[model samples]
Target: MASTITTDLKNLSISEPVVIIGSGLAGLASANQLVNKYKIPIVILEKESSLGGNSIKASSGINGAHTTTQSNLNVNDTPELFFNDTTKSAKGKGVETLMDKLAKDSHLAVEWLQSEFDLKLDLLAQLGGHSVPRTHRSSGKLPPGFEIVSALSKNLKNLAESNPELVKINLDSKVTDIKVEDKKVTGVEFINTQNDKVETLNTSNVIFCSGGFGFSKEMLQEYAPDLVNLPTTNGKQTTGDGQKILSKLGADLIDMDQIQVHPTGFVDPQDPESHWKFLAAEALRGLGGILLSPSTGKRFVNELDTRDVVTEAIQIQCSKANNKALLVLGEGIYEDLKNNLDFYMFKKLIKKITLKQVVEDYKLPITSDELAEHLNQYSTAAKDTFNRPLVVKNLGDEITSETNVFIGEVTPVVHFTMGGAKINTKSQVINKDGQILAQGLYAAGEVSGGVHGANRLGGSSLLECVVFGRTAADSIANVN
Candidate 1:
């Protein structure tokens, strides 16, 4: 039922056992666990009328080291290996202990979402920077972050209906301020979007699952000045409301300068405000796709480099090619690598009208002989045991004949901050004074920081939400 608070209720006081702000995966997962385990009466305040925050727009899947499917296919992976790979992906800056905890608990998180939450996942193809294949995703080739959030939202609603002592949801409500008393949080002040009414909710605990400040101009200027001029794909609501609150609360921040630039996001080269066209997943490159520079008509960088390296290389490739940027994919590549990749992303690009138009506009050499030579060189260079082939080295006038190669250009857009409200292993938000702010006040998901260190791995954000979400619940249940 669509519900709204009227002007007469502007000063209403809602007292709950616990109050959670934000309805993303982190908030929903933590609420679900808390209500199920302790029967805690919780109120979830969400700015959007519907659930799933920025997660609803995710185009990628969660990364994990589950051996269920990939292991069955003889792809060996262990928690230790997963940890090491994640650190390596972050250029050795990730917190070792934190990554270890995530890897160790990832299987259980996956299990809970699948068995208890009714979320589905398929093994996603490994991308550049990892030694083994371990991405897990839902159907729709859509980002499983959305699926997980949607599933947890349903669970929250069900719990609210059946267990009167458990969770309650208030949508179209924005948390305007957090009320603090004597260094302890007492409640939150929220404004209803449907009407201009404001209400104060008193609670013993406050959990922030609001996402990063990807869409906040001030945050971009402060943390990621280099990307201030580029395009972004983050949701408008991802303006990092939680970060602003944490900053005001004097929370210590880390890695605010380290930002990941997703290279495949299609943005309007002319207008920066245009929504990021869905990014072709890096999984595509792992499945024999190619990254091409339209200016020089050549490929560059191993498609599998960490996002930083790939984005940097794309910039170099485009600069070298006279500032022209575009990507290409061979038709046969989809045929051979489709079954091994996300089919939705595959079909989206497979039948892309822009691709055909781009190909036509560039007048790329598509003859049988030219194609065969390019394939031979690409095949020869694509032979990395741990890395994808750097396609720029393989494209030549003499090369031609067989093999399909998909190419894409660069966005170099700063998407989100990898750092914010510092938290301990228990997901307790810590103050700059080196003490926990409140006994029951916890944070999960992107709002809680210190996990991704300098750079985040491909699918670790969602995994962080679920893993820490559960841990935060356990901690909150134990809170006195």
Candidate 2:
């Protein structure tokens, strides 16, 4: 774990290394499986100077069904239940085969992470679009993203030292082309960002783990023009580099227009208009937070519902004084979320403010009594417009002007793209016209769609990287 790797570009030319584009969760998961199982010669090409991509920024936990964590929590869950929830949330937009596979393999994926890196995914929370408590993280101070990615990165670094000839990591390297011979992927052309040297790796297998187009204005303009004005929670490197390479080769694309606008990107008071904003994690709401409208002091939507439903409610319901929604949490929720809140507060995404500041700063046109009545009514209501649970933990409790609470301004951001190159259950890329691509090529992660339908459930993105990334590695092993 102490070793570091920066492969000399010249050495890759002689090795015929299996090229994996992008160094995020998907690439790391694939490489880990390939090296562990087959000792396959591997080269991970990352455009960024660092390893972990947007994956390290993931705040919510990963999804798993019927895992040991769920069992320990005395939560009854099964793969069938998870699949049904996913299919229902997808609303017929998800590929049935892919959704079913994701649901079935989820627990194993979580188990793999725990065993492989000695990482604990023992903490569970019920995020949006989930029927039960199944999403998992560690019981540590660091967020789940950093914990999982750093463990995988550390393992790979140490492996590069111990098995230098079997594994190589090339940073600041962007894969520009997938060279094909006889309609089979043979290698890739990439450029070193540190120096402007163009390079190529000769290999018969290539896995596209490159991320989505959430941060690409041009790609958004081309594919999702209406969403171009929204902010994003993606890294600058997620400009659909893999999509461009696959599309030109006539690979099939799925749900290109089904972009997901996450309901809660924090609006920094100091810089509210910036296109890049910190995500107010869905876990914040899962652990009992509430969303309020400025025009009215009452709850606007079921804070625990699917993200799309909540985002639409905010857009239609929040008062026009600010294009934002008010998120509030009570003492109990705070106790469960102190670690995450500390990071958000340090980033100035959430902070303590006076009750008067709700009106003066957030522009919520409500009196202290009005706010109290809203809390009281929400606490006791049997049926509401949105049908949210009446007894939310630590929220809708007694409130005075002096009561301590956590609050923030949140807005919908273009968070995830549910569309990308099409891949089957086997993780083989398919042509848009419903044909399979070359045998040696594969795709996983956000770069490959159909795992999610119209909307992606919270915590499933990381699960996807492990499930399908390893699936691709297994496919490659079988092919060779």
Candidate 3:
């Protein structure tokens, strides 16, 4: 099903190649996979002048199944465990078969990024909710999520150089409408956001990877009103144009209410842009980090709970105190998050000598020692509680609140839409009425639905790209 050279550029005055709707990781992964595997022509349409949508701004790493490193640690992990954890975290709303497929493919995705793309993976620490160490981070200090996208982008650039006809990337092209005939996508109508010029391109398939609507205040209020105005770490370009467009096309949307709001989003009132500067990945919590409610002067639920659970806990803490809670982090927690900490957080840490100093200076009631004693005691108890209930030790006063407490803002910011055009396991995009539009109209990455059931794990999105990318390519190649 490789695309044929059906149209000549000279005769049609075509300004682009096979049209792609967004320049984010999903869009880029699709283009890179197609070009590298099939030598198909591609045209990436980006609304902004620069590349890197919310996908590039991500700080958390990607989650894959257990690796060789985990094997050495004697950490027993299987695809079944991965699938179970994901579905349980998502409250069984996620599709089990799809989760199973992704679980099996996760490891290969990690391997491909490291072996083929030269991306270094730090498999030492695992993220939240999982017992085994499966989260793979980028080596050195680069943010885990962005490093994967950067590697993919770099590979795409090399592919473009090696094969000039493979891809034609156009920046500032914002798609407004998708043209359809007999319920099948045929072309796209867009405007050059830079010059205010309109353009249209004919294509057999259209992929929407324009990111989620996290940055749009109006949409956030409309969709998840509960989390409206809570600080978000999402990129400004994540306005959910792709999800909105698909909704208009009568796609089966699932789980709009299930939003994953991370516990920590750096907030600085003076600089609005810095309000949601950077996020410390949930991995720190999984590694014994404590979550504190500074206003209430107490620690709440486990920080390692599923994102929604943590969000609810934070909201309750805020409401009970009649104000937004301030998050406290110990120096150990700060050290682990140093690489991905945003400018605001980095400055906050630099000015404060220790986690306790931060609380005293900011006039926050919580301190680090109190939070740490809680975590250390909890960690010791957790070892025996799940298997056998242990005698609880009181850790309230032994340690003062020295942990750094930043004001907590947990609202539903549009992060990523896990739902999209219906696609089979092989990644073939289907129509609204469950009809196959075209043989080669395949989709991978975030544009293809069913990968994530309701909510996604911290690092699973990037893994989806590589897993489905290769699957789509191979399926196309094998199809007659």
Candidate 4:
């Protein structure tokens, strides 16, 4: 509990700390930039009782282009190539300037995190919609999200201890509204859930780092009605608080219907009907995990395709039955994804089983021999019918009836919302008429849109947070 913030409303009249809403990666990163780079004071207001909102649950890694790690691994990748890949996946809704800025500064963002925390993001993977392996993580110790959040939170606490006026973290503080005067944003009004007393903090600038609306029932029903029935990988605090509050002040929202339905959310055997499910990280598929039809016991679609493509394929193929598919991971893949395997197995979301049990328990029409033959095609074929190039070395190199593999049941779930208050590269919140809405209001992270258009590639979400979060702070520094 890093709630080192004071309940002293007396300071509000004299203090000029930049008010940051939310304690997720974007907020923390932007706060870091403000205090460290600009020597500015900040007060982070988190609606949740804990730090690191949805960012703590992130299992996939962060994206970068022309990074030191990529060069060390001899992976030929450039920012232009990364930008082109993002544009292709965005399907025309992505803002050209924002996407270009994201790709260009991606390596700097990765470098900033490593330098600040002394983190060795040595592990790399090639996720969907990327031409090369640029997603960086740890060496399989913990999830990248947890590691980053822990480091950032600890550093902020240390800074607060050194000088309480510099960095303040107020947990369990739910901001209800934005206070404005003279048609310019002035401050924020919030109530600490612990005491239920409302307070106001007046400042020249306000930055919204709150997340998207994936877990909010009312928000989903209002904006993305079709996805209301789907479960989410987001935390309960991710209720679009920033967007709802800011929209009242003429902030223009964009792409309200562009919700991302991830292809794989593990269905727990113990609680299959639970509305909340753990996400099957896309890094597993990047490491050669394959998706098979439960009834036929054969591969149906390319596992490395963009999330939307994979989810649509699963729904189309499994529509006849339970709308579920079997995600299979060979021994090599399980080892590569070791960081996430224990929690997955502990929760019984994934099971360790032999190939024979998979065939018998799933009640497939084909025999064990037929399944082996289909899998062995990966060893000799240049590419499969789905154009899945570069078959992993250990996975499917040799198939046997007694092969030990990890398996899980996966279904489509609402993972990300690509719609929110629209913003430019400078992180200034804009109005519907394409003008800056206020003098001292900014938005970052998933709360601000136009970075990822229709679909978001794996690993890019964290990158967006780091890049835009720091950009918002920089923009404010120039203004102030």
Model 4: runs farther than 4 Å from truth? 1-15
Ranked candidates (TM-score, high to low): 4, 2, 1, 3
Candidate 4, residues 282-314, lDDT tens digits: the string is 998887888998767888898889999999999
For residues 334-433, write the lDDT of model 2, one tens digit per residue: 7678888888888888877645566567656787666765676666667556676653447535665655568888999999999999999989999867
Cα RMSD of all models vs. native, in order, equals: 5.1, 3.9, 5.4, 2.9
In model 1, which runs have C-alpha deviations exceeding 4 angstroms?
1-16, 92-94, 139-143, 162-165, 268-275, 320-325, 330-360, 363-372, 380-410
lDDT of 3: 0.61
Question: Candidate 4's error at 461, in angstroms?
Answer: 0.7
lDDT tens per residue, model 3, 26-115: 677767766666666677888888766767766666777766545765767888898888887666674566678889988777777778
| Model 4: worst 10 consecutive residues (lDDT sum) | 1-10
* Better model by lDDT: candidate 3 vs candidate 4: 4
| Residue-level error in angstroms, candidate 3, position 14 | 15
TM-score of each: 0.84, 0.94, 0.82, 0.96
| Residue 209 of model 1, lDDT score | 89
Q: Looking at candidate 3, what is the lDDT of residue 118?
A: 79
Clashing residue pairs in candidate 2, if any?
A: 252-431, 252-432
Considering every candidate listed, which one attains the maximal TM-score?
Answer: 4
Judged by lDDT relative to the true structure, which candidate is superior, 2 or 3?
2
What is candidate 1's lDDT per residue for 380-449, written digit by digit as tens?
Answer: 5546433454443323333333323344444566665687788888888888776887666678888767
Position 404, candidate 2: lDDT: 59
